[model samples]
Target: MTKTKKPEFRPNDFVVYPAHGVGKILSIEEQVIAGMSLELFVISFEKDKMTLRVPTNRATEIGMRSLSSPDVVMKALETLKGKARVKRAMWSRRAQEYEQKINSGDLMAIAEVVRDLHRADDQREQSYSERQLYEAALERLTREVAAVSGVDEAGAQKKVDEVLVGRAA
Candidate 1:
């Protein structure tokens, strides 16, 4: 077989894992297991202080993907400015849906959760569950926004918050 090429993403490239959000590709190397050589992509999630190794062939199957393009990032940000679209279902049911969206690793879905769960200062307070889900979505969004926009998490958060406030206003 031909020597492994550069692969989809080179070392130091940023990637998004569906369940884990963003992680950096530290390196790609072959490991021996069960007397067979297996190629893996070593990834690091700095914010979570975690490292993962996924089989090179299964990276896409596992939802490992390159970071969103700037245009896509802009679309995700614009998603935040949309009006909240809360379903009329029960709280438990709605919570499940929001969790699915957040874990989907799709920026637009995460943005929807943020917009729906957001509570303007004058609005009624959110329940504990709502608050937790909202924060998770916000954090996930902030990380991606920061990576794509070349800003720190705090800076990205400010931009997101500004958009939310403008929408609320």
Candidate 2:
């Protein structure tokens, strides 16, 4: 059988972990466990102040990946400009689905959640849980956008807001 080559990611490279947002690779380490040598990627999330150790072999399986490309980011922003589709389902059910989408590490899916939950200044306010979910998804999307665009979080947020507001107008 032929062997498949493992994906190579280097130290100081920015990566996205599905459950988390953008993080930088601090180092790659190897350790012996149960008589087996395992390699790991040591990633640090500055916003959350958390470090994650992911097995090198399982990175793809776990959806760990490099930052989204400019084209992908443009598509995600386009997704934000689309009309919101709030299902008639119960809030709890919808919330769970939104959470799943945000955690899926797909830029478009996260954009959908942000679009659906976004409220204009004059619109009715979001419920506490709804607000929480909106912020979480927004944060995730913005963090990646910021990294990919070489902008600060606030600047990325403004770019996202411009799209959302333009769509609403």
Candidate 3:
């Protein structure tokens, strides 16, 4: 007996791939790989010329998904303005976990990291690794936000900072 594959990805669909948040499906094509033919979705990111091919049936299982709705995006933004949780642990350990969450490509997770690592007007300076992690989280979140909001990445970053500052003020 053989298992059948179900197709969940469609052309022109917007999907958030872990690590590269938001991209649009360019096409679905059959490709031969080592004497086996398989169907894959070709996704393209406008900001970058890179194209990603994902297995049609495993898109969801692998955490590839469409962008959250407006309400979802708003909720994620609101989450960014909340309290920051800094664990009292070694920097190496914390850095590893933060890296994993950023690579997860989930908007909420990215937002959590951004919120937690965000520096305010009165806060002390962050360490080199901390700054690196914060920048990575912010970059990942802004890219997704920009794609969803139809704004540029820098503009989206400013929008996020504005929201955080508004809450802080």
Candidate 4:
């Protein structure tokens, strides 16, 4: 077994947990689990109003990461302006893929989902599940964009909208 390395994080630092979008580290604390003391990172998701405690050693393994860089965010926004690539598979299958992408904590993957599932004004509407998946992906993308760009959620959303509408600035 590989030795669990200590994670490099501190309180109040923003991090991306794979299953949760963006969260701030509340504090690092120790707790006894099955007679063994364990070190954990307490993370709070303000948007979800939830708190999660994860083993500090497990953070890297579980895909917890620092915020994306500006260059990466710009690349994801560029992805938003591309053509949608809906696969020929069934909706259920496609939906599963989209769900995975949204929770993957990879900005580009989430951006692809937003681009693929976006419905333009002239286009037909999406199914309920499609709408849900699209919104989830958009929300994840928006949060990361907001955190990286230092913009509010509304501003981040507007920026995404402008790109989707072919008026990216």
Return the number of clashes found in candidate 2. Answer: 0
Q: Provide the global lDDT of candidate 3 against the true structure.
A: 0.84
Model 3, 5: alpha-carbon shift in Å? 5.9
Candidate lDDT scores, in order, read 0.88, 0.92, 0.84, 0.92
Candidate 4: tens digits of C-alpha lDDT, residues 34-64? 9988889999999899999999988998999
Compared to the true structure, candidate 1 yields what TM-score?
0.92
TM-score of 3: 0.87
lDDT at residue 145 of model 3 (Cα atoms) = 83
True-structure RMSD, every candidate: 2.1, 1.7, 2.2, 2.2
Instruction: Please list all clashing residue pairs in model 4, or write none if there are none.
Output: none
Largest TM-score belongs to which candidate? Answer: 4
Whole-structure CA lDDT of model 1: 0.88
- Among all windows of ten consecutive residues in candidate 1, which has the lowest summed lDDT? 1-10
Ranking by TM-score: 4, 2, 1, 3
Candidate 2 weakest ten by summed lDDT = 1-10
Clashes of 3: 0
- What digit string (tens of lDDT, one per residue) describes model 1 on residues 7-108? 587789999888889889999999998998988999999999999999897887767788888898788888888888988999999999999998888888
